[model samples]
Target: MLALYLLAGIAVCLYVYVLSLDGPESYYCRYDNQTHYNLARHFLDTSDWSALHTGSGAVADEAQTGYYPAAWHLLVALVASATGIDMPIVMNALNAMLSGVTYPLSSFVLMHALFPARRDALFFGAFTSVGFACLPWVLLLKGQLLANLLSFSLTPAAIALVIAYVHAGARRHWKGLALCSALSVGFFGVAHPNGLFTVLVFLAPFVIHRIADAITQSTWIGSRNPLRKPWVVWILGLAFAYLVWQAMLYAPPLQQVVLFNNTGNLNLSWAESAYAAAIISLYPEQPPQWALTLACAAGFVALVRQRRFWLGLPALYMLVVYGLCRCSDAPYTLRTFLAGFWYSDPYRVLCCAELFLIPIAALGLATIAAYAHRKIDRLSWKGSLALVAGVFALVNFFPFYQEPPEDQSSEVSGSHFVPTVGTAVGYMHYLMESGYDEGEEQVYSAEEQRFVRKVLEMIPGGALVINQPHDGSAFAYGLDGLNTYFRHIDTEGTTEQSRTIRDHLSDIATDSTVREAVRNSGAQYVLLLDQGLPYDEGRWLIQTGEDYEMGWEGLANLTDDTPGFETILADGDMRLYKITAEESAEDQ
Candidate 1:
């Protein structure tokens, strides 16, 4: 058992080492990352943590006043302040290490809490968790979702403490574990409310089983107060956790997100959602882990055959998650109502299922190893550990072991055709290719970031710059202390003046309405960017097409002799123009 633990620890460390390939400075940029980075910068600049606010655009904008979950932002701010290092480096390092270290250790802790005697299953399950690709790569790549990542990474540890409290069985053992469990649950809630929902879903089966066991024992003894059982301790612990969550919800920011955020709408039909859920949960990446999925099935069958029903709780949890994922859109069904609490997203629901599936997959692998050991004379426990370690190294780091490309310049983005998934090679490739090299999902390139700082120095503080969020000027507030017309991709709650400017800014020379809108929006400079990347062209147009189109036409219209505009800077794909027309149509 000790050797198994040591081997697992070694493998986990190696995984983190692999993730650190591009050093602490390199990060895959996304719009959300920019938004959160700006939030953290705001916190640092003001030293105010009362509520989340982005000091960009007009005061009436949602980006300026709307509330957001702030745990991830707060942590980044606190770390940067304490270390006095750059915020980007701190943000990237902490985000990576949190997922890299917490994930595997939390899986091991949860497996041990559930089955203390099954070392083989525990080892394989936790080992498998070290390679799980869905959350770290797919979900992270979606938006650089740091808050979601932090919440999910911590869920297993929180759930493990609750399970320990559930099985404590005595008054002396109860209070300490119960308090710990409550604190864990409290922390998980503030990290992300979706994670709190996940914890409750995962705990339902265990709580039910424990309550049933308490009832059966009470019946056998003919005891009174059967409701006053050991399971009630877990309930009290959860109640305290609830109190913690409720207290945080008292804050207006949390209230806005929890009570009135846009969530819970169904995106697919029942069967389609179920199929998508299964594919994302089990076969999340290319060359899907069919062997691991089959192993999970085999493990569940073995548990039922061996009459170890308690150990198969994760399978039941998966079933409940599947039902919720697929049935959330079915009108008149109970799930339709309950799905709101879980956010009604199949990806999130199935990600929770995938987390629980880790232990079952481990058990299946262990069962296979045991069978093979019996049949083959040479295989031993040491050999099993070695085999697991070898597999871990091969799948994660083997493909990217060769020499990197010759041109390691951060100015030009690189391209890789193969899937990076969760491998260390994948991590480096993502930073170099999609982010710095090609700017596919990236908001800004290395050169653009430098130019932004120089542009900030040129402009006065608090001056509003006309910008399209998709063109990367949305990052101005976070990366440098400059305001922009659109602070984020979402244009909800924007001022009427800003909206008019967005649609007709290019007609400022001839159109009276465009001139009036620009003057009213605080006549200032314009930040234009080259529409080169796939996203810049049209990939994410559903959300930012209007803004991109407006910016593209404005850039084309602003030549050297264009009326009411003077080009300030035209470096590569980025252009900064000074708005020369302060006179409105009425003034003219």
Candidate 2:
């Protein structure tokens, strides 16, 4: 049964990978393309698997500074080492495989924990394996899928460990369970801080159950106990393990959480929860109608019976989602929801709760079956209801497909593609090959292409080239040069010298100081866009220009421009500036 489930899961993963590679529109190509490219480059160049450190790339100035957990990176690096394949392709394939492994493993563990006495664990496992929300995010190429997979796999094992400790009343089991819990929590924390939030929410019910057990201990004295009481030993073991783990694994990075908080606020909205719910339950395009109907029936049963015990997962999920959505004053929109999703996506938390619901829904259906059996013909009624549920579950799995939208252009750039999803597939291959085929090679545009050609002739390799009149030109021409001067000025450790350069550029159109600052900043050539004057404050310098003329206003005051700087080439709207000096005074 497990083998069958594994095979099915792998088949689905491969299908999704093929779909992802179809186009950049289906994946998050633009949103995270630069970051993923840089990270892959780092892994290939330095052989360092730690995502915590910044990559040595063009975007390092803007990249996140904290350490990312090593799990995904290690997998990607291992694959690269073995096959000598491109890091991007390897990472995508690995993610696809991981996604396949998680669904069945999670379902099996969950069934074992929830229905240990039932002989039909496999049946329940299959039901959960096909549920709508269990592994929905696996379609994407993001870290979230990996994080979700780890959490799902670890969560069930942790729950099973806890159940065993409670039922066996053994000190050894309690110790082992405590250790498992700590490790699970640690991995969830490092995988994504949001996983930590979900883990806490899941544990809340267990904590309450423990307290209640202690308070009602006397009431159970005369009863035959189905579960054991090794509470004292378990608590002590967990506490000791937590202390050691905190000091060794969590402390270093946690200490800097406060530092990250200020810059981390990407306000999210409540609408995301609603959007996710709609997609999961009622999307007209690809509705999981059977699953939705089953969930609705189960929810009705839970609500009518005031099943607080069974409500733990759903209730906790609602609380967390509501807290994230309502706590902030951010505008309520899909973009906001996606932005704040970096902290945690409520859609994901709801998916985890959905896993817990399969059993609840199955049990509800089973109860009805048993009732009909007693009322009518015992065997026949029970068999009929079971058959109905099985049919519904199968329906949820069989179609297993999604259609490409009719309007491809409209679909490509929007929220449709998530960054992780795009990178996992081969969408990036198109981008890298669309214009320039060689790394650091420049492709010339008619007017702007001329300027680029000239600049390349003048500027020395590794020189700090700044465009005085075009900010977006470098990307347009595939020039790999520093272009985020305004952003760099806002960086945490902005030197006074860098700040002076920024302030000068802010009003470059009217300020001679701006021109001198540009000259001082080591720009050898200036391309002035014809659409904007040299004094136009709106114009920002860049490596390419669609319609610009070369200027030498700032060059007259500089001594030895030949060795320190020179205009090496020029054509139409572009010009090349070269730095001749081995070391500038400012650099010294």
Candidate 3:
């Protein structure tokens, strides 16, 4: 039975990562995957396990200094080193395994801990873990939120450990459980602090109920010191977890990286209607998938009908936290502070909601199976097989969840989550669509990518290549280890010379100041996708309009006729220009 469950997990992983598993390139290159891949590549190239900087120059001079959690990238680097696999392949496989295999096992552990006797509920829940598209599919692909993905995988295990410790037999070895719980939470906090928040918010009611039970039991026994309870063990365990987080914060390798950033309130506030939409669908931009949505409703009904208040309380409390996190722009300072704990991020809160929903959906499945078993006693075995088939179909083929109704044109209503097509023909079509440059979703055309590869082959390994962040050149660093000037969309901490080159590179033919800036900046070449389409200005994802303002326009104006530039390569609108060292020196 366990082997069967493991196979199911593997199948789930294969479904999502089939493209990358068979190919050398990573999927979802249009988003942050490039930056993350670059970080891992840096670790691999330098062989420095302690280094956190990517040398992308998105932050400070000649290096990226803005604080980002890179432990996830470090792990990817280590795995690639140990396995002798390519970094992109390792990233895809590791993510696939984490989300597909470990996630289901963790869910099983949590469900088993919650309802020890209900094997039907736990088993059904584990099987359906892959079907929650809001998680492994939608959220994973949208921003390629790698760090958040790690934390999501670890959260259920942490929650399950806490449950085990609190409910352990009096004679059982709880010290070990406490230690494990602390480590689970400590690792979770270091991976992504939002995960620690998820555990605390989800389990707050559980601990309070335990303490209340202790008080009531003591009162019935006529104990005078009811408030002076013996629940100090749990409190101490939590304190130890906090200490672990603090120690990791100041550790030798991670001391320089600030875990939190003061992200100001900009598009963080969730309108009431948007919040309602998210709750109903549990997805970012689309309407609810009625199949899973109805199952979740059934799970809620089962909890209430079965009088499972212990499980119901925490599940309900998570929704309350989800609601509170939407108050990013509330007038009350305290309420806003509550929202800030989550960075007022909607996706993080949605992840928290899914943690509880998985088990509830499983309960719904279990309930349906039970009713079917009673109605068809002679065909119980056959019915069970049919139920499994239905689950597999729903996991991969349910198509009722479409883009928001055409009439709906709200800010949050645009489609962001693209579901994986189960059929080979459909998947092939999906790939074709993703590679089409005419669409706003794709970042580069096939010709542009080929041009970039040829340019990388021509340039020496260490030579600096100036690039517009919105164009295909932004991927050069990660794609072929090229030294690109712009690592991300923003020029947050770039040097003055790089800024000057960004804003005036087109004037290299006429402006001595621009030529001098280029010479001082040590730029050897410029790469451009002059006629390429940028991402949609109206989309809620990373806004590219700022990229234009930052300098893409200046870079786009370069041509073969430009005096100080020599066209080294050109494929359609994509061009690579070599800087004329003679002109640069004369200008100097």
Candidate 4:
């Protein structure tokens, strides 16, 4: 069964990846993950263990280390460094590896915690994988999200530890269990900066329960009656105080690294919010929504009656939190903190709830299959599960077998995740052989390729290059150059570059002002998008993929003939401009 879990996990990951490879394109993910990949590449190249770039920069430098979560990238870099494997390959395996770890742990939790007599670990593993096979967030955003998925995967492990400790049946083991919980939480704190926050938030009910247990047994140090007495309140009071102290110590430093995009209020109806939460559907394009809704409902009801439901409480809590944020009339501070903490996007509630959803929905499948097992004579429950898994595989993925969606635009409007296999193969071959030039518009043209390489060739080592609306392209594949004047800055803007550049460059308030600002920032060259825009802008999954007017300004003014701009190269639709006073005066 353990071996089956391993194989099933790897097989499912490989199945999608191999299919993804069927249509070869320069980018594994059409839109996102470039920033994360480049960031990992930087860590590998620099051997620097401190600070990560929220956006690209020419003179990429580390800021306060503890403020930002670098542990996730560090793990990716370490594996790539040790094995000398490509980042793409590592990324390909990133979620899969974590998810693989997750399946077994989840199964163990389900088995020991829920269905020990079912002899169904294998079913649990396979069913769970298939149950989430069509997840939009996992598939649609693929490489874009690192910490969310990692933390979500760790959910099973965290819950498993808590459940195990509770059931450990030894008083002495409680100390070890406490230590384990601390270690688990500490790792989450490093893995995702807000990870411990999620764990603490989710584990509140359990914590209160444990307090009650201690009080009932007269073991609580301060509490004689945890339930009815004020002692429990005192315990909570101390916890809050400690949290406040930790926040003061940690938050300011994190402020140095984290930037929150303005996540405003979302006034969704209760039904709409609950529906989205039930489906865990952040990106509607990735999979059919009704499927998830149906499955999640089944699992929710099935788990509600079992001991495992308690285990899912944290996940359930996150879902409730998401619902609260969706309420327009919801308290400002509470919604703002929860919603803002989640990329300032309300739909990210789905991400926080992902781990919780996985086990719940999977158990829904097992519940149905168990019913079949008892009722059906010829087909075993495992067989029914396998059949169900096979059906889900086809239903979820069958859409992509047809023509792939063109670029990111089609991905949003259409019903599929990526372009057709044929599309990828042809594009890759064309770029490798000829490079994009003339009318051959694909994701990127070869001229821009040469232009970017030339920029790298000319720029001094460690020098920053500015690309407005910094698509992970320049840094993802560019010549040993990074740092951005405009574009692709991660939220929670804290870096010196992000703050400085964002003010002047965020909006091209004045072309001349931006030009002078670029020159003043010590930037020698800028990759101006004479033509080209991302398939999606400011738009991402939580909005159900909504495009917004671009936040990067000054593109309309980036004419080669404009002041402070000398055309170094014009490749395909993109133009490279040199930033110098002499050129600006000439252009003016």
Candidate 5:
């Protein structure tokens, strides 16, 4: 029966993921995902595990895996290798399955930890898997927070061990529980260190409390504390072995990432930090609209009524993270030092907060129904709760469901693609208002894709290319797995690295600085898109042209006016150029 439920949940999540990819009406290419895909493709073709990225047509240790965790990339490569599926489809499929499988797995762990009755566990597990509130779907669709998804899915399992350890103490079977906890931490750390750290921030206190309680009990009861168990000797032995293994095998890569990613600058003011913290507290981005807010509040009340205080840990967890995020703003460096490695990224924190929030909010509704059943015997509370949850999901969320008409504002603007489901005149109208149809987007054309491929084919192998104009140009390098000015997009370090490269190119025509920068960065070629390509603050608009850009201002002129560049290819909207050796010479 659980297997059946798991399958159903997986099917629903996979369907939603497809919609997210197909119906965005915007480009769905994530820089990191595509880069990793390119890396994975290269990894399989060469059977080289030494490097996670290609440099000069071969795997190079300078791969970004040294910075970004390689576990997910490796997982993708393994799946692609085993299934013989195309890279993109494998990514979408595996990631969708990750979302799907996490739903059931999380529910099972949480329900078992919190509830006693098997039926209650199953029902709440299913509900948590498919939330009544649509927040998780919102996060999942963005589709870049794969590590957060994986970590939080393991969260319930980790917490379950905490509960078991606290209750079971030094029992023989509890040894298994400790082993499970260790494995959970190991996997969580490998999945994403930030996520593992996030989970630890929540769980560590509980673990300490459990140990303290056991020690207190031990004083009277002659060492009942699990820490005193003989198995602890084995645990220590195993931990030492693991540490030695890490020191021998994993230390260099981890050290490389930590050193590379140290972008030391403080930006958050106290007021700014507090405000950002408060906003993500209720929803990952902002407070959920009033209706969803009410649903969350009901769950809040239910948890409090039941004395399920463990659930409040997520709230506190977010608070600490947000505080640490801005700790760099504080004086004496002590706070920042102690806070060590808080990524200070509002959007990243928002993603993590949402993963922790949505499932608990779903369980919150279940708690309310269970509470209600005890109060009034007239209706089937469970049935009613499920029906309400189901209707809310299908109506408001199925595919970018609309916010309440009154709740609509700047936050729910075009970027969100939220429909107007609440304002529907009647039942049939609501049905008609389900959401946007799939494949209704106007993204880059197939001809544009083919054009990109043809250019890749024509460009000399092992020649590094600098994509001009900096708007969505990373796509080309990420697509082909070629070394370029930039590669990954998920990190601040990578962003700054890419920016520095582009800054040099910005001076290509008049300044030898661009040439020096290109040569210094080990790149040889630069691709210029036709001018007239539109840039709206941060994104590039796909446009058609005859040597005309997609409205990009700098692109077309740079190709024509830029000296010290040798044109290699001119096809439609794209042109390729090689930086001359004199271009690399320092200006006198």
Candidate 6:
């Protein structure tokens, strides 16, 4: 059974690798992926991983520095070192393969732990591992995909530890369970912050159970308790491990990374929860095939019937899902479900819950199958054969039918670029092979492409540049150049300082003070996108018309009118202005 499961995992990995090879076009514009890739490449080229600085000289603020754990970055750097492969490709491939294998491996572990009976475990693993809800998203969005893989992988391990510690008759087993739980939780936290969220949710029950056990055992272990008592050892080991992991989070570098650029806000809304649920439940182009859908339904029923404890996982997941969904009342608005919880984006959380639910759903299906086999002797062979056939067909065809939706216009323009992993790679390859001139103003398909080429050209000889719209632009362009500095200036006015500066400049309408500030920033170049004039202007005007209009005046000093500022390049509606003190100081 294990060998069969391993083979299934291998097949899934191959399928995902092929998907990763598809193209550069993704549902989301590969903005975050590019950001991580660029940063990783910069780290590799410069061998500096301490500061959360990008090529655009934009340093991460206190809260946002450690948003991504170091593991993914390290992997990218290692691949760059060993094979000289592009960091994007390497990282994408790794994420894809892991995503492909994760569902099956996780399901196998989960089912086996929950159902010690071999037949039950195998049945649940096969059925759940093939579900539509689990497969499609994991195989698509890179960030969510990678996060789900890590979360699923760690979830089973953690659950196993909880089971062993709580149920094992021996002290040694209990100690081992505690150690394993510590490692799993620590690793999960390090992979993705969302994984940490999932781990916390899973740990609630275990923590409660453990606390009860500890209280019960306290009297027994007071003075002359047996050293080998299961509960005593389990409690001590868990306590030690938990403290150790907690300390790791507080380590100097990790703490700095976590707390960097911290912004406290409640950004959730009730509307987002409904929208997310709708997206999960209905938005895909095609519904799951009957077989898999039925199987999942069955597994869900089985899980509900098998153990009361299993119900907690799904109930907690739903509560989180609903809570996160309710973070916003308006559709697509960024909001939070609870106070003090930073916006990790609950859409991704929905993805994680879906992952956990798959195995339970699978168990439900297997339970139905088990019942059928036991109830009738002659029908057993027919039922078993039908179930096996259904599993095979479902796994093979459900992912095909349940295709990811096309990238919405908002996703294209917004920070999230939604594209399949394959499409992204293909787009990159196309750009590289086409040898497209960076100086030309030809329209490019992907927004990042034009910006990436422009930045690449400006810094061809290791020159420094500053990028505006720091979210994607800073990360994407900084990868190509050495001394890139991100002015940390958000044209959209994301921060108070930026908003105040924008407002003051607009009020003053080309104030000398603002120009001086821009000049003094030591930025050699500035990049801006011309989003079809009136609309872009209108949006900015709405955000800060007076300040925005004023800031534009300072830009003249750095652009066509200012002697110090010269248009070095313009491509696909993006304008790059270079700063020079010698030419502009006197004029200013």
Best by TM-score: 3
For model 6, residues 1-588, the per-residue Cα lDDT tens digits are 566566665654454344434352222323343345555666686676643333422432222433345555656677777897665567656665555565466656666665676465465465456444434343244333443455555555566556656555536587676677678756665555546555555555555555555655576545555543555654675676557556654567454433432222113345543443433332222232345445555655665565345334543455454454444333322222221122333445445555556555555565666677777677764576467547644443333321134454323433122323222222322332232232322222345555666566655465545443322344444333434444333343243333433334222224455445444444456555542234333222112233433443332223345444567777654666665543444555
- Give the residue spans of candidate 4 off by over 4 A: 15-18, 21-38, 51-66, 79-96, 99-117, 133-143, 206-267, 278-282, 285-309, 326-331, 337-344, 377-447, 454-526, 529-568, 576-588
Instruction: Look at candidate 4 and tell me the lDDT of residue 171.
Output: 76
lDDT (Cα, 0-100) at 380 in candidate 3: 77
Q: After superposition, how far is residue 389 of candidate 4 from its true place, in Å?
A: 5.3
lDDT by residue (1-588, candidate 2, tens digit) is 566557655654554443444332122222122334334445555676665674433321334455654455556566777797755466556655655666556566655655667534345455545444334443242323454554554455555555566666646577777777788667765455544544444455555555446544757554454333545434654576456434533346454431222222223344643443433431112233445455446544754575335334544354344334322444434223322332334345445556555555555555545555677654685375666456654655443343335553324633322222221112222332322222222221234434544454554653455443233332321122222222221234534444444334333434556545655555444332222223233333332243332332232122223344555554433434444332354454
TM-score of each: 0.75, 0.57, 0.78, 0.66, 0.64, 0.64
User: For model 4, how big is the CA root-mean-square deviation?
Assistant: 8.2
Distance from true location, Cα of 560 in model 1, Å: 3.7
For 131-194, candidate 4 gives per-residue lDDT tens digits of 4533223433433456666665565557667666766653758888879888987777666655
**Cα misplacement distance, residue 571 of candidate 6 (Å):** 4.0
Which pairs clash in model 3? none
Candidate 1, residues 1-588: lDDT per residue as tens digits?
A: 445544554454444433443545555556566667677777877787644343433332644454455677788778888888777677766665665666666777888887788877876765566544454444455555677778887788788888886777636678777688778666765567777767776776567667656665664654555445655645665566557545654556344334432233333456644554443333222333445556667778877887555556654555454555455455533442344444444455556777877777777777877776777788897686567546644664444422334453212332212232344434433433444333343455556667777888888877778876666666666656667666676666677766667666777878777787777668588886653344434334234554345434554455556677778987866788888765444467
Clashes of each: 4, 30, 0, 20, 9, 69
Per-residue lDDT over 1-588 for candidate 3, one digit per residue giving the tens place of the 0 to 100 score? 355456766775565555423354544555676667777777776786543334543321554344456667888888988898866677767777787777777777787777788877766765556555556554465566788888788788788888887788523867777688778766865577677767876676567557656665664555555344545434654566457545654556442332333233223345653444344444434443445665667777898897555555555655554555443554434333443445555556556766777788778777777777777768674576467547645654443322334555344444333332233222322432343223333464445666777876898877888887566556666655677777676566677777777677888767778877877767788887654434442222254653464454567666678778888887766778898844666666
Task: List the global CA lDDT of all models.
Answer: 0.61, 0.44, 0.61, 0.52, 0.49, 0.47
Residue 95: error of model 5 in Å?
A: 1.7
Against the true structure, candidate 5 reaches a TM-score of: 0.64
Name the regions of candidate 2 deviating beyond 4 angstroms.
Answer: 15-18, 23-27, 30-37, 48-65, 119-122, 138-153, 210-290, 299-308, 311-316, 319-344, 362-386, 393-395, 398-588
